[model samples]
Target chain A: MEKFRANLMLCAGTGCVASGSAKVHAALRDEIKKRGLEDELKIVLTGCNGYCAEGPVMAVYPDEIFYQKLTVEDVPTLVEEHFLKGRPYQKLMFKEPEKKTAIPLMKDIPFFKHQVLRVLRNKGLIDPEKIEEYIARDGYLAAAKALTEMTSEDIIKVIKDSGVRGRGGAGFPTGMKWEFASKVKSDIKFMLCNGDEGDPGAFMDRSVMEADPHSVIEGMIIGAKAIGAHHGFIYVRAEYPLAVQRLQLAIDQATEAGLLGKNILDTGFDFVLEIYLGAGAFVCGEETALMRSIEGKRGMPRPRPPFPAVKGLWDKPSVLNNVETLAQISPIILNGAGWYRSLGTEKSAGTKVFALTGAISNVGLVEVPMGIPLRTIIYDIGGGPKKGRTFKAVQLGGPSGGCIPESLLDIPVTYEDIQATGAIVGSGGMVVMDDNTCMVGTAKFFLEFTADESCGKCVPCRVGTKILLDILTDITEGKGKESDIETLEDLARDILASSLCGLGQTAPNPILTTIKYFRDEYESHIVHKWCKAGVCRDLTTFWIDEKMCKACGACLRACPSKAIVGEKKVPHKIIQELCVNCRTCYDTCKFNSIRILPAGFEGDPYEFLGIGAAAATTGEKKGDA
Target chain B: MPRLTIEDLKKIKEKHRADFTLREGGYRAKVTVHMGTCGIAAGARNVMTALMDEITKANLTDVIITTSGCAGLCAREPLATVEIMDQPPVKYCDLNDDKMRVIFKEHIMGGTPVEKYGLVVGSETTY
Candidate 1:
């Protein structure tokens, strides 16, 4: 083989590719060739680096320098400065949001430092398209061990001892699931991988499938050996074209290398794997519904009496695992159950990967040991809320999960602890919200998604969610009655109890948790007809607080509707007829002068402008909203 | 291709150990060729290529080859630094492909600094 002095691991994951990593790759190749440094350095396009907020990222090995946000114009200078002169370029390195200095090393960056990469172990370290790179990292060694050295019972025992649960959301013990299927007498058993990650704002499984597809494959290989399964299917959604392509490539590579087909590792263990693309239905993420979908039926759930372990995917005994759960199996087999149990809590004995997004400063994917406090993941790893904003809540587990308030931020993030807060760490999508977000509108946002995605298999989910969405929309549009909150609560509880699958069962979580934590916002919308966050235009009256106004005319320039009437040294006022309620003035005001009042407040605007004075204190003078 | 046995997996791992060492960081010795504009202008690339060829020819996986910026001494172009585990770093200046080959054989392989080509025996101040 050939030897090179250094390796340039450029990120080619979906996020980076969307941010133009392909153009960056071409620029790098051209620059390296132009400088005659092509032979001395090797450029390898790897998977997600996890710092997606800083896309077009690259890590130069041997020196360990990390560069971010590389443009085509930067490629020539970067090649001359770093690649040729061997000096790490500081211009494109990651700079702390507050600090001016740049961080050069990827290990030293806080976002990468605090993460424990188990599921994402091969991410950004190897070329996802190369099986050799995967094997070089001891990728399939566990599959080899499970095939050649361990028996079917032994593999189950090790996984059971490791205490890893289903990372898909339910937190069911993986070993017990495998053991149940192993006990059933079936000549043709199935080992299925749930890659149908349907949660909005969640891409943890997609990253794993795209970055290290072989890890999932190797995990399935071990899982198949454990459960006596001769056939497997990875059911990924059709929306993830990159994940599908990489997974297909990885399967072909593994089969060609003789690690995947028949007689694997010369142990006579045969397992054939294939990919099944889902047509983007949210309910298909449910195991039973996923199995039904694979059987060429409409992806709907049946009540779990047989539980897929007894009857699944053509009615033979089967075992279905999440993409993340399978990615963790190889490491457990190679390093023993004790090693896997060393980092996390006793019950949730492993790390979980979270897709951090929304108003958070660092929008990326992070893997942290289970039981780490929600505060650390938010403040330390996420770098807190975006600048000029204060955190209100973090919506975990996507729409199937609930919003955790600031009061519970200190709680440890185990399966039980998060569940105690009325939130499951369901698929680990943490969307941070700032103070400007209206809680009622946020609840309505999630309700709209669930309402649209309800498969209509059962009456409760189909009818109840639509009713809930209608009530939320009415409240946001200033048509709320005092009794609507109680009605919403009752309907949400009924849907949660009577839903057929995981989708409907957990769809009401956002509404229930938001009402529990931010009921004051809901009441304000219903009775007072005011959205203090200025999100719902029908319930908001924009007013200028003259005491704090700077007369800067910034709002005048920013308002799209030409509603502001003011001159130099004069406080600006909105012409109510022309004001579009766009919240541009509220966001544009530098002096905190713009205040949201009750809808159609005709009383003295200055009366409630004082801090802590309620618009309702103006008494019967309130206009009809 | 034939199906691989357990031995083949181990063999492939060993074959790729040298390539992964650069990324995973477990090497007994490190050789940093100062490839600054001044160094590269004076044949530092030749010195680097020669050192890499020597390591591959000797089938050594424990030695790392890397590059860095200028060493603050442009007069001594084509500078190289050698640091073994738990030992002070040694700098060699004004080198060519032949001289790099000799340095690899005597200093890198033998674990002893070649005093003839040595400039300094310690690193610059960090703080």
Candidate 2:
């Protein structure tokens, strides 16, 4: 086999592709040909590189030069100087933020340093659409091994030994789930891959599906063989068009290659895989609801105890695992149980892929060992919060999970560790929060989401979520009575205990966790009728800081309510009655003079700004006098 | 052609193992415009089309163009990363027709990595 002297691996993942990686690829190819160096240098378009903030990204092999934010025009120079002349282009390299020096290799970056890529191992390494590239990396070998070498019981035993749990929120033992399905007497068992990821700010499953569709397919093949299931269904949400397209293409490719469909690997066992597109309902993420949707019924959960293992998917024994769960199976089988078990803590033995988003500087997909600390993920891997903002809290597990304060920054991230904090690792969606975030408002946002997503199948979820949202809305709007806190706690406890399914059972987590960590913020809202973050419009009063205001007409021109009325070069006075508190004037002000005060503050609005309980306790307001 | 079976795939893999040349950058340059929903919202498709038309007009054979999904930075779209063999790769932000041309003439052919326009500059050994 002929190997090129160098390989130029461009990030073709959705993030970099949008940043114009295709143009970069074309320009490089054109430049290489123009320079007559085509045979010596290669350009490989790979999947998501994971460092999404600095894309369209590419890494030159042999030298491993990492370039960020590329354009099509730069391709020729890169081709001429680097591929032909063998010179490193200094301008295209990545610069360290704290240090002024440019970094030469992709691995040297701090973001890539801390990540343990297990699930994301093949993400940036192969062409997802090409089956040959996947085969080259020993992709279907595990399926073949399971089909020919291992018995169904042996496959289940190996999986159980791997200690791999579900990456989906529950963290259920994957092998045990398979074992139940394998032992069931049904002649037609089913394997279901749950791609109905509904959590906000979460896209790890979608990325895996888009970047390495074959991995999920290979995993399903092994799973099907283990469970003695000849039929499989991938239940993906319709919202993820790209994941859907890629998954369908991958299924087609696998079927064409005889890796899927009847008599796979020339073994006697026959299996068929199909796709089931969901209508983008958050409730369908629940196993029962998802199964119902698959059965051409409204997506609603039925009571458990019979569970899916006993009677699932048209009343047949079925095994359902999330996209990430299935994706991990092939690797566990390929590497053996001990190899997989060696990485993480005792309970959660494997890496978890998180959609690291929100106030963090580098927002993208990240996979780390289960026991890694939150501090490491936030500070080291995430490049800290955006704009040097102080870390306040990190919300994990989406709306169904809870907010973890900075006090728990050192806490190891595992199923048990996170769950111990009253937060489940629900689908690995981690949204970082800054100091400016309003805990009450954040809780309210999640309450609203849960209220909208509740299937209304159970009265506790249907009615309780609505009441919770109403109370939260009232508190944020300064109409909340002090008794509302007790009411919220009461509702949270009842909802947790009585909700019909996982969606309702975990619906109050955001509220419960936020209230637990930042009860003071809720107290401030109720007692003082104030929004500490000035995010709640009803509790805030916008005024101009006379010292800082140049009386620039910017606020006057910007305010839709015509709230700011003052002559140029003079301090503007906001009409309290006419001021809709729309915050247009506050946003438009360049002088940083706009201020928001609690309802009772008479003068010097800045006194209320940034004054937490410490200032109140000290009885010494710096700017008050 | 018969549907490819696992045996056929194995045979193909074996056959390709000896003769297959992992072809280096010979075809015309390939431009992958991120047309993922987020990228399109960021205007990646227009930028991609501009680059495509430019390469076509220039009669560039070594280039192949394609599209990809989102790269996380919803705030910055129509972003493009450029790679040439010997030179360091450059990513241009807020790209328009003019910047694309400058990239085509200066970086693609002239062997110079553009400054100012790139988010990160110079190569590192870490990744």
Clashing pairs in 1: none
Whole-model Cα lDDT of every candidate shown, in order: 0.91, 0.79
RMSD values for the candidates in order, in angstroms, are 2.0, 11.6
For each of the candidates, what fraction of the native contacts does it recover?
0.68, 0.10
DockQ, cand. 2? 0.06
- For A263-296, candidate 2 gives per-residue lDDT tens digits of 7867877889999999999999999999999999
Residues A454-549, candidate 1, lDDT per residue (tens digit)? 889899999999999999999999999999989999999999999888888899999999999999999999998999899999999898887678
C-alpha RMSD (angstroms) for model 2: 11.6
The lowest-lDDT stretch of 10 consecutive residues in candidate 2 chain A is A616-625
Residue-level lDDT of model 1, residues B1-127, one tens digit each, is: 4566778778878888877888888889999999888998999988998988898889888898888988989999889999999899999998999999999999898988999999999988898
Off by over 4 Å in 2: A26-29, A543-580, A584-595, A604-625, B1-127
